[model samples]
Target: MGVRRVAKGVGDLLIETLGEAVAEVILNLVACALLGCLALIACLCWSFSPRLTIAGAGLFSCLLAHGAWHTVRNPPKGRRRGLAALTAVAFTSTAMTALFLLLYATGCDCL
Candidate 1:
């Protein structure tokens, strides 16, 4: 009973942390895309910027697009692994953009 309880506790901890990390990675991707849009909005100004937000939605939409393009361009033997990698990298970058935007929105930097 004691060993089983300990094992259960350890399993629970591993699952919780790993699950959170995975979720963070996914959200980070979406957040980065959203944040990039916000930053670009600030830097370029709406008048100067056009179609960029749509284009910069790299976290989700961009990933899918790039993935499709790579798959089509390369015609993967089994699967478009290159697209998957590119999409993942793009997601991470977009997440970075999102985190920055979140900070900007909250004005946490000043604090």
Candidate 2:
């Protein structure tokens, strides 16, 4: 009976840990998707004005570089590497979107 209880306890712990990990993953993915959308909107806004577009492009480039650095710095061991890449991409896209938005709001003509 004691052995059975111990086995059940271990199984419960494993299940809880797995659940937490899965929840974290889901949250990360959602955040990334939101960032992508923001970046896309900034890109669209850039089309209306060249100066703003240049600024937006700069932001996009920065994000790309950052993402590349992240991927290179953290070599993925297995399935987690893919997740890390996705996270980086999401972060970069969101940053670009934010930069473009700032440019538009600032009204700075010189890029």
Candidate 3:
């Protein structure tokens, strides 16, 4: 019974550590994505033209595709997987939103 308790304790510790690591990774990804968005927005403001707007939208679409690829390739297999997946989805969605906004600002219709 004592050995079983020790094994369970170790397992719990491993799980906790994994959870922390995954959280840190997700945080880093989010930070990077936000920075990218900010830079894109700044560029758009400085160059308020249709070409610049289209470029911004293309950049965002690329970012979304990259994130989706990462999410699909690695996937979240356990407790950490769900958080990782969520992070990817969030990043992709934000990029798509930004792209749409850029398109709208440029008076471009998507059809």
Candidate 4:
């Protein structure tokens, strides 16, 4: 009876853990995709109007926030490296855009 209970407990643990693992993978992939899209949009919107650039970046930022929230809600799954690369690229693009706009607005008067 003792051996049977131990085996049954192990099986239950495996089932629950596998389900959580699968969920973790799905959530991570979704997050990765959102980050990738943000990076892509940021790259392409360099020459776009300030309003559109800001709007696009804002939308992606929200998506990223959502993904981040989920990641935090379920701790234990490791972060994917690709997400970091995507975020970095997006941030670079967004910063450059903002800098360019600021310079344009100020007429780069320092020059």
Candidate 5:
């Protein structure tokens, strides 16, 4: 009877751990998707309306910063690779945003 109880408890613990991991994975995926969609929309809007583009880029930067802050605080297991990738993406996006602003400020005819 004691053995059976221990086995049941272990099983419950395993299930709970698995559920939490799954939830984390889903949330990360959703966040990545949202960021990607925002970037795409902002790029598209850049040619149409500078105001809309700025809004989208600002939102994207805020979300990215929040995600990075959380990840740094918690440092999830097996997520180092993901963090590195996100960092690379963040740099590129930031550069692009800066370039857009610079062009706009200069009143570049190319834009």
Candidate 6:
């Protein structure tokens, strides 16, 4: 029947979409992990210099905030507000950390 054929087509399309989404998520996780490892190495090597260390942390915070903001902007399905709130928390924390580091690096004894 036409109804059966349409249902089968819809199912197939859903399966294909799910498969692609899963694959994309996996690929993104792998890439992020690799880049994170590289950043860790660079940070470790740069630890001998205070300025460089601060720079690295600041750069990392900026990147994290950017990513979080992007996620907030594009929000995922079925829990958009919750996800946006979580991302906002993440962005705020990163911003605070970066600000603290900057102040400390600049010789503030506010600790």
Highest TM-score against the true fold, candidate: 5
For model 4 the local lDDT of residue 57 reads 65
Clashing pairs in 4: none
| Candidate 2 lDDT score relative to the true structure | 0.67
lDDT of 5 by residue, 1-111 (tens): 999999999999999999999976665555555556756876779889999878877877776785556545666575456655576467667666556445433432222
> Clashing residue pairs in candidate 5, if any?
none
Cα RMSD for predicted model 6: 15.3
Give residue 108's error in model 1 in angstroms.
15
Tens-digit per-residue lDDT, 1-102, candidate 3: 999999999999999999999976665555556556767887776677877778877876676676677666754555545545565776768767667555
> Which of the two, 1 or 2, has more TM-score?
2
Poorest stretch of ten by lDDT in candidate 2: 102-111
lDDT of 3: 0.67
- In model 2, the runs with Cα more than 4 Å from the true position are 49-111
Preferred candidate (TM-score higher): 3 or 4: 3
How many residue pairs collide in each prediction? 4, 0, 1, 0, 0, 0
TM-scores for candidates 1 onward, in order:
0.38, 0.42, 0.43, 0.42, 0.46, 0.40
Of 2 and 6, the candidate ranking higher by TM-score: 2
* Predicted candidate 2 versus true structure: per-residue lDDT over 1-111, tens digit per residue: 999999999999999999999976665555566556656887778767879878877876676776767755855565545645766876666667667555443433222
* Sliding window of 10 residues with minimal summed lDDT for model 4: 102-111
RMSD, each candidate, Å? 9.3, 14.1, 14.9, 18.5, 16.0, 15.3
TM-score, candidate number 6 = 0.40
Question: Would you list the C-alpha lDDT of every candidate in the order shown?
Answer: 0.63, 0.67, 0.67, 0.63, 0.66, 0.66
Q: In angstroms, how far off is 45's CA in candidate 6?
A: 2.6
Candidate 6 or 4, higher lDDT? 6
Candidate 6 lDDT, tens digit per residue, 1-111?
999999999999999999999976665555455455656887776877878877877976776776577565865666546545655777777666556445433332222
